[model samples]
Target chain A: MTRIINRQPAPLGRLVLATLPFILLALVYLLASDARLAENPSDKLLPSMQSFVEAINRMAFEPSRRTGEYLLWVDTWASIKRLFTGVGISAAIALLIGVANGMIPYARAPLSPLVRALSLVPPMAILPILFIVFGLGELSKVMLIIIGITPIMIRDLQLRTDALPEEQLIKAQTLGANSWQLILRVVLPQLLPRLIEAVRLTLGSAWLFLIAAEAIASTEGLGYRIFLVRRYLSMDVILPYVLWITLLAFITDYLLQLLSKKAYPWYHAQLGEK
Target chain B: MSEIPSIQPIIEARQLWKEYGEQVVLERINLKVMPGEFVSIVGASGCGKTTFLNLLLGTQQATRGELLLDGQALDPEPSPERGIVFQKYSVFPHMTALENVMLADEFAQSALFGRVWGSARKALGKKAMAMLERVGLGHAASRYPSELSGGMQQRLAIAQALMKQPRILLLDEPFGALDPGIRKDMHGLIQQLWQEQQLTIFMITHDLQEGFKLGSRLWVFDKVRHDPQQPERFGAQVTFDLPLASEGAKQAAAEQLQQVSNPTTISKEQQHDLSNAV
Candidate 1:
């Protein structure tokens, strides 16, 4: 007679428990969609699974009438290019500035205050300014994502570097490491995995900024397509696009986590014990 | 103090004092340490035993006097000439035990890269492996510090420190976190390494028995004067300096240390006499 609080589920039971909410939500959506469509066949909201599947098929497999290109693939590639470019630049800048800020007082004294202040400012508030400065091109959209996430990632990495045990630094110095060597060898290797983790954490916000920028000004992108179709109440296309973006984010996060675990097994091992 | 040997002292501290603003931590510490002497220091917590180790390690500068290494002023920064092992976090968690040992040579040979490659890396790996075998962590060479047990990690730390071939080794309670059984094994390993390397060692310990069992010389740090109003006004000094080269001297010093440490074992009158004698 185990108490409910103390009751434990077996592996199969756990799997069923994990998917229960999603299944329930899907069932409710199907019932509501059926009811709406029965009353009004042309209902735009909560499209049926059949309409969703047809919309996905047209977007993914068929060629567009105007451009003769699969619009879905084109939009995905465009968005991914901007996302990765912005995130890549952010990662490089965060690594260099963050490690410097953590290890050197001189580096920290000037930049840390500036980074802290920048992180406090709402990144979305400056979207117009970024668009004005960088123009309504790819640069502005990429800049938005970079500006949104770079400061946060830098602050995260700096704290991680600062949190490194003082003993390791001393031990490295005693082992004849110069300041540069200390940063390059002892500090950089350890902070790289942390940078990956920080990037993973910030990917969601990066997507938000990217989509906002594209929705405002873009020729063709997932966000642009979704926003363009919103006028006609194309829930089928828009809902699938949203789900696609979510799937992409999940896959990217999973890959980065796998990279961290594989490339830096010692980091994960250390985490497990400490 | 015993008579100074004719051989040139490897390290000499002349009126060393460390003060933090108005507070004193260590005061008037003067000593002449010959080469290859295993000096074990024991004191109550916050008596500046670790501070003395830091001064010797060149991580902390003395406020008032000179700390000479090889008859020259010791550098204000740590270098390969002096190696140190802290109680914990001494080993790099990101590195395998073998790579940790090889790090010293890598830093020395490749100043810019902090690593060697190809043939040079292979050769260094072999040398590091030999050192690992000496410390008895050869089998766990590929294991990360976290994967190894505490005793093995400390052995890895010792092996890493020895890679630089330092003349002096500073250990700040390196075995404090270890279980007693594991600690004994570490002691044997350290003693073997010390003797084999002819290393001049300075170890700080809270365990009096460990201090007596290991060192050729024992240093007891205690305050000569205490202020009832302000404890920070007075600083600790080497109150008891005993050379344990002879068995009789070791036994007598152990008894004295026991009495000083355990006040319940002695009457108040005897305790008063002991403090005055110190």
Candidate 2:
């Protein structure tokens, strides 16, 4: 009998609405965990809240008896450093290659097709080859991430560079900028925000490559820790580690988004429409 | 007659024929622009005015011709000696007015990095601020181009272009998008800047009265003057070139404005002719 209104809710209402799903998910998980634990007290798949707390305390607070170092901190540090190194190298090379592809004919003629073909080759397929070439060290794991993400990032950056208004390039030339100067000055500043955005977009794939490489080999990493304990169905440690990786990814994405907003407000405004 | 060498015009074009494939854009353009001249061009859409300006800007090469700028052979390359402003898309939208103006200075001062660090940065900032002030945008230095009014953005674009103190300034319908009032203000500002800086300016506009008002000389781009049967065969050329008296142009321009405002009195034939002239 009453009329139904389909109007958008206010900010507070929207926030509550958004959080509702997460709260319901947690509630369902907790209930299932309780039911499983009541049926079988010795169950390890669905660990209790007390078990999670104990695991975190031991991993975070207590040093490893073998190496006299906190394994959790060690793993987190190792993974982060390798991730950044791989991503950094990829970003630097991609920026140059992408700019060349967009700005110069010689580079685009050869590199564009090569990058397209490389992007089609599933990076996971080359994991074994990378290990064979670089050995079972950090080099191979980092290389895997780089080879996986660089082509896509390069393609992204080149497209963005190409999409920029031709007038700016012309304007820069009239302002006394040489070809190299134009690329370094006018083109680079504009592409940076887009580069960061491209990096953010490819992070999931980057992390996947990193974890897969770690799980297959390596002695110390979040991925290595999870796989090492998997034989005994150590869901508690695995679950926390997965959540930790997700948390780290979220923070990285936020920091990058913040950097782009602060450094290139104009780019963000341009993208805000989309 | 043989005692002195021939005086070179600031810009000289000889048999400048521009084409794309079989399509002729600009045909047989032979003209000279002397130093300190305010030349305005008017034309209909697709008459190749933009293409001509591009040639002047060094962004495009003429299919056949020898172009001389400042008595030197014109190459198909852009350099800081010539500056330009388009109808729109002039300023970098991602930067503030201050950053936009300072970008060229930064690049020129430091070739690769394009950053002015420490005291040098401060000195550059002061210079950029002065340029912004020259363009009547000193107060809006921190504002983004998107935040500025249309006229303000144009002024910022002018400031950015003038940072290098270019030998020649090219404006392609620079104020075409502004309102009538803002456009009038812009006209005054450009006039003042031109006189103070002693700049050589070439502007392309669609309004005949605007061209007549602002320019010392006017170049008309029209396909009608070439061939009606082969209208598409030929693009445009400098069909009519006329110099305006400094005083009479203002008065005549005012008269033309009044005449144009009286739309009801104008016959259909007059409107048709006006449309064709555009």
Candidate 3:
């Protein structure tokens, strides 16, 4: 069995470095907030000091409330279940269409120009058109997200497939491997690393579109909740939801990196570095 | 050696012609190779020796002639029946030595086994191990091609070709990449393997010494033709069938083998005296 080592661990020095910036920012904010706290604070410093403190606090502790309070506690089990099912269905559909279109030459040739043109039209630009067609429903939001992500995913997948080594393909041909066999045995193994990279990138694009999708046409979801808070200028709730989205994106990207490393160890070995 | 089988010729090329955009590489080349017969084609750099090997391996198609294998029309497709070991040691670098040998077995059984990993895998693994042992690479089976020396890599390539159970082995300068000492060892290993398997081998090399050491019958491609009417001709083809005895005789004969470096030097007094003495 191969021994996997933990590359990063928390030590006193790391802990100090992590907290140093925040600590200095807090001190500056406290001193400017009041003349008594600093020995001398002018009227011009008061408003700026209050805003800085609010931003700092918002950044520091907002995520725990979003994940622990809003996502896990208030939303309950049903809401989390719906989020996963919706995302899973969207990802599966996008992957199937992307991979199929990417692999077929004629399909890619005819559709690539249209897809490139569509990608330039921002997800938000289609909101009014989508709402007029599908109404302000869950389907409209999911459709919007899918349409926004499919083109990017397809482009990435196509580039990955095209970038495969010619020698491997020729070897497969000389070995008497047919089309399907070539794809399954030779192409797929070589494409795994790039495909995983595409997935990570597309996943980020999906999240960016998620907020737009929900803000325009949806009654529920983390994005909808954040939009509802924005109406009242409730920075606390808005900050927390944004924090949740960022954390989820980081976790998903990290998971994909780990999975790619495990599934395509040969690629990493070829790179001659971890 | 084992009993010489009365089987038909393994490879036969008749009036074979290969050309690249009006430059005729080879023309009207006819040859037949019997089982267990070791033949070496020695020629200058552009004499189409490699092209001939490629034709036999089915990697290259003849421009205007017929090539047959055991009385059947040669298929313009690569198969395990004709294994090729190239000068570059064309073994897959990512694969271990054992895996390279096992690739042939895998390809042979793929049709019937349908990629199932059971008896076919076990049998191929055993055969690969035995082949590696024969090539003196049993201990290095787990090592990648890059980790092995040049001679070891060539040995592994030979073993892989042999593991395919090819009817005839085509080697295009298999030991041309090795040093002189390593080349001699590889020649010995090739001779031993051919003797043990009774493999019909056709090798192409510019090294006259290697050809003489390994080939049972040596063929030289000279541009000067021997015509009765003309006392001297600029271009002709000369074929020498030297007898192989002990190492000393083989070495001496190899030294006497003339190269086609200069077409005009064909009638050199030294060559005339050597030819007359032989």
Candidate 4:
């Protein structure tokens, strides 16, 4: 009998195995679209590949007569700007709060409870409250993403810091390191890579909050454009926009992983990851 | 072991007691250690061996009494006067071997940045590289701890610890995780370092033979009294302090070693008593 547990695919075979599901998915989509279009040429549920192509060209290639700008590019730029701004600020805040909560008892006593309480509250449920406080502008949209993900990132980073071996800290102290020196030298460098991992994990949620906010109140964003066409049941435009957003998220996640690999090879090495 | 009356002890513990809430870990430990002594400690698991080492390293403070160094009260915090190497995680994983060694000098010279650049960095690198070579890790200067073997990592940790030129070195089961073959090499390395640097060393070991073979003085930590109803009421203390320089103590160590090796000949209770009384 063949040993299933011990068997693993070779590199080339693994690549083929990886692509098999995606190819099957596309084929299924194509066949379903063909069947739907055969019944009714103008069906909105399953738009044909030809309609998808035409929608992409109109949104990406042609400038609108009223706005005189490519709609897809404009929306993409707005969405990306808001997403990165929110994530960047959250990362900065998480670093400070996490280090404080992990290292010092005085800071941890109060801040840990606060972060725990904040992380428990559902971020989407506070949409109206955020709009009322920050107003319906870019600030409110960015704030929504921040409010959604910052506490979680802070908790993760704090736990990572707390999990560092006690021996390392004692060794640093024995080497004549003061409090600030220990933080700058011993703790910060180890934490940078973990911060990146935290960001990578929360990027999905950040995108969710961003899209939700933009769909509620915005003039030009990927979420806004998708919601704008949904009134007429324009599946062709909506489908491509969703695919583009997925592609962007995939690229961002990929680049973050690559950056982590290049910047902190020791982390991956310790985890025994290639 | 005759001693000069004018000579001063490097470390002295007077009625030292370490308690955690209601549980007593170490109790009434009083001893004096001269400079250039290699003291090996042996005990059972959870017997407060590491706690004693931490007390020496200044990571943990005694609940009562005094721990002194150089005729002054030792600080309750870790300082450069005492350096320590643990069984694991003593060296920073984020740094290369050279960088780890250089960190001591960095922390000393640049308090704010914890870094030095330009010519200062170059000079520090040279010194760190020399220290690494002394520890037999010169060829692996740029390698991170993750890429190193267990023995090599321990050597790197030793190099990092010695960079501050601490007078007292505390090693907490540093060779316990190593293979037998690697442990012999480490023993040789440690002996040579202790002699060359004039370092007072305190090492904890579970191996009784290793404790006898390496230490100039041997200490066995065990509870002299135990209560079945309340184990936390008692704490470990130095039950045996043998100065191995004397011929009589050396002969006793050999007999104890034989008794330990041939455990089936004696009752388990006798063996426990023998270990405590060694």
Off by over 4 Å in 1: A1-5, B1-6, B261-278
Model 3, runs deviating above 4 Å: A1-187, A200-215, A220-247, B1-7, B20-25, B38-53, B86-113, B118-120, B140-157, B172-188, B203-259, B263-278
Categorize the docking of model 2.
Answer: medium
The residue pairs that clash in candidate 1, if any, are: none
Clashing pairs in 4: none
Q: What is the DockQ for all candidates, taken in turn?
A: 0.87, 0.57, 0.11, 0.79
Q: What is the C-alpha lDDT of each candidate?
A: 0.90, 0.84, 0.66, 0.90
Error at B57, model 3, angstroms: 3.3
| Runs of candidate 4 exceeding 4 Å displacement | B1-6, B246-249, B256-278
lDDT (tens digit, per residue) of candidate 1 on A168-230: 999999999999999888999999899999999999999989999889999999999999999
Candidate 2 lDDT tens digits, A32-77: 9999999999899899888888888778789988888898899999
Give a tens-digit lDDT track for model 4, residues B32-142: 999999999987777788898888888788999898887789888988989999999999999998999999999989988999999999999999999999999999999
Q: Residue-wise lDDT of candidate 4 within A1-274, one digit each (tens)? A: 7799989999999999999999999999999989988999888988988889999999999998889899999999999999999999999999999999999999999999999999999999999999999999999999999999999999999999999999999999999999999999999999999999999999999999999999999999999999999998999999999999999999999999999999999989988933
Better of 3 and 4 by TM-score: 4
Candidate 1 vs candidate 3: the lDDT winner is 1
Per-residue alpha-carbon lDDT of candidate 1 for residues B77-101, written as tens digits (9 for 90 to 100): 9988899999999999888999999
TM-scores of the candidates in the order shown? 0.95, 0.87, 0.64, 0.94
User: In every candidate, how many clashes are there?
Assistant: 0, 1, 6, 0
Predicted structure with the largest DockQ when compared to the true one? 1
The DockQ for candidate 2, computed on C-alphas, is: 0.57
